[model samples]
Target: MEEVIENKFIAIKSHINGAPIEFDFEVKTETISLSAKSKEVIVKNLYVSIDPYQLHRMKSCSSSQTTIYLAAPVQPGQSIDTYGVGRVVASGRPDFAKDDLVVGLLAWGEYTVVEEGRLLNKLDPMGLPLPYHVGPLGFSGLTAYAGFFEICKPKKGENVFVSAASGSVGSLVGQYAKLFGCHVVGCAGSQKKVDLLKEKLGFDDAFNYKDETDLNSALKRYFPNGIDIYFDNVGGEMLEAAVANMNKFGRVALCGVISEYTGGGKRPALEMLDVVYKRITIQGFLAADHTKNYGDFISTITDHLRTGKMQALCDISHGLESIPSAFVGLFRGDNIGKKIVQIAHE
Candidate 1:
């Protein structure tokens, strides 16, 4: 007789419109029959990344609208959507086998059965940190690399500004700009993050956005000459201020607009006249669109990682049970770097 292991999962119990996530715990069987196992692999999840973008998808948006579908809404009572690293426990497929490590989309559970497309290329866990696959070398790293080099064509001696600068992607953006000889200025919500950006992350200048009552004045004070590149993460009022202070032919990488992700009410609007007057180019992008360049990105970033040229900071929460709180912390700006959940390995 084939041996089976019991599994436990945490799933969303209901849809939340404008608040912290709600979840329910359930126990279930880990393995399926032969036919089901043939198409899918059962994996023991190791770590889950807590990202601000996930909060945007947790809400139930009407599918009837075509103009606004940033992310697919999570079905009520289903497993929450996230990227995780796992070890394959059982596999009927030839490409993967038991004990193989993988990183890709996975449910927020101890064990999960998933079809193949979401799985990433098998990784060699030796000589590398596991959390880097989730942080600097993972999704956040890709976003920062692509946003800076691809979307925003930075020149030497350019003045660059990044919002939410101590978070996952922002810290890297600032560093990359500095490497290219651009003067980097960053804004964070708290004083601690500001210190991390300037003292630790090597930003030329940084400030607590929360402390600045007049955002436009703050931008002027920081970049009296005007910003040449803007890496926008928190969009809304700060974006508007960035636009008002941009130089001629400035570029803006619209990586994420976390400001509009929550609450059912009206989203904040931006003033677009600056795009015309300043000849500013603002482009929105997703990491999925840049997979072709992953090899190139990994080569450059990994080299930096090996040398002391680049550094990564991670804010990890322990256990699968802390998933909801880890996610909630992103909104409250409770995390210093990348927010991640560490599931125990048995």
Candidate 2:
């Protein structure tokens, strides 16, 4: 017998400009008609990631139009776009069954209906923590791995710098550089994050960027020999400073610019002539473009995380209702690590 469900949903009421988002809660009716379709799975969402990259997409841009060709845009009255982990409650696919766990793109809702191509491989929570799929083993870890090793091409004993150093990707990039035998330095907004970077994450040294108005002076003081590689997470005045202090032949991996996501702002004037004079290379990357290498990224990070060689920090909000607040927190610098919303208690 097929079941008809009246599902409660939390949707984005409208685009927001500040620290909190507007949401519309509604009930929608869905039937089991999807079961007739092959390779279809219906799941109950458990956790959703609150990431900075989503903010970049919220703004109006030509690139945004191209990126979400397959997905629906967030209309004035709609659910926000979010990636989450869910457990299959019903499956019409041979590969999945009742109670199967998977991680992939989903809306900020209690339940979702996914057809072929949207579903990801099943995950074993025993191999990794469930939320890690939202953090390390998922997007954050892969972003750090691909950005640091693939883009920056870090060398042993090189001097490495990471901005936003205590967040998900920045923290991993710093530690990954340390693991590669590099002299790693990092910058954070708070003393607590700075302390965590230095003492817990194995950063060689760290400082609070909030306290330093002159980023150039700060970089010069920290890297007296100049930075060999810069894993940039915040692209603004700090990026300008890092560029000014880059060593000859330095490499930079542009990961994310959380600082400029909220307001369409201009970065401080960069000395591009310096790039030519020093022969510096700066490259920007989206993690999805490097998905083919994700298996390698997962294996390596899983080992590190399992062995306690690497650590992931998170600022988790309690419910699906809190998704808006969690997303907004990223812009306010209120979250200490990866911002995640727990849709339902495990």
Candidate 3:
């Protein structure tokens, strides 16, 4: 007889429209059998990623849904699936077996049943922490690598600017720019994050965007000459400022717009005249769209981490109970790095 497991997972009480509060989420319990069907696997989740983007998935109607199948919205009471690291407990799949460590889209709860066509694969920890697999070595790393090198296409000695520089993807992008010989500058919401970018992440310069009343002037101050590449994670005013300060033929990799994600910030009225006159190229990219570079990214980033050329700043909260608060912290600028919840200790 198969043993039944009581799984505690996060579910929304209602679809959120504005910034999510802790009250928006609730813990729900379910009973599952320790069994798997053919081509399916049951995984005990360890670390689930806590991301601001998850807010979009909780919305009743969001543009994110149309952009990618992964961003499809979930209704109230449905399990919130996120990228995470887990240990396989039961498997009917030939490639995966018991005790295999895997990383991919898993539920926010204690266990996830992965079926065919879902993103799940065995993970090689490479002597790094399991949390690293959830952050720097996982979704965040891929997003930074692809958006900077693939979309921005940086050049040596070029001026590179990153918004939300202290966060997961932005921090890695700044490090990669520095390693590639590009002059890098980053902006964060707080002074602590600015210092982390400059002192720890090896960025040439970093500043608190909130301190500057005029964002355009701030950009001009940082990139005195002009910016060659702009990794935009925060849109609205910052995007407009970056566009105004970009040099001719500059590239903008539109990653995520943290500013407007929850519909709080006003839409940016960018100067289209500057965009046209400067001949700038602005492109939006998702990490999922750049899977071709995954092999190279893992190899290169692993080497960088091993050699001390890169540093991963991760902020982790413990237990499934912390999921809601950890997510809400992103908007409050309470986290200095990647915000992740350690669901279970490995």
> Candidate 3: worst 10 consecutive residues by lDDT?
336-345
Q: Between which residue pairs do clashes occur in model 2?
A: none
Q: Can you write out model 2's per-residue Cα lDDT over 35-108, one digit (the tens) per residue?
A: 52577888778888888766544543425546644233455445555677888887878998888888887667
Candidate 2 — which residues are off by over 4 angstroms?
Answer: 17-37, 60-62, 68-72
User: Each candidate: what lDDT?
Assistant: 0.80, 0.79, 0.92
Question: Of the candidates shown, which would achieve the greatest TM-score relative to the real structure?
Answer: 3
lDDT of 2 at 114: 81
**Which 10 residues in a row give candidate 2 its minimum summed lDDT?**
24-33
Work out the TM-score per prediction: 0.92, 0.92, 0.98
Give lDDT tens digits, candidate 1, residues 197-255: 88888999999988999999999999999999999998888888898899999999999
Write model 3 residue lDDT over 241-341, tens digit each, in one string. Answer: 99999999999999988899888896889899989999999999899999999999999999999899999888999999999999898998888778888
Model 1 clashes, total count: 0
CA-RMSD of model 3: 0.9
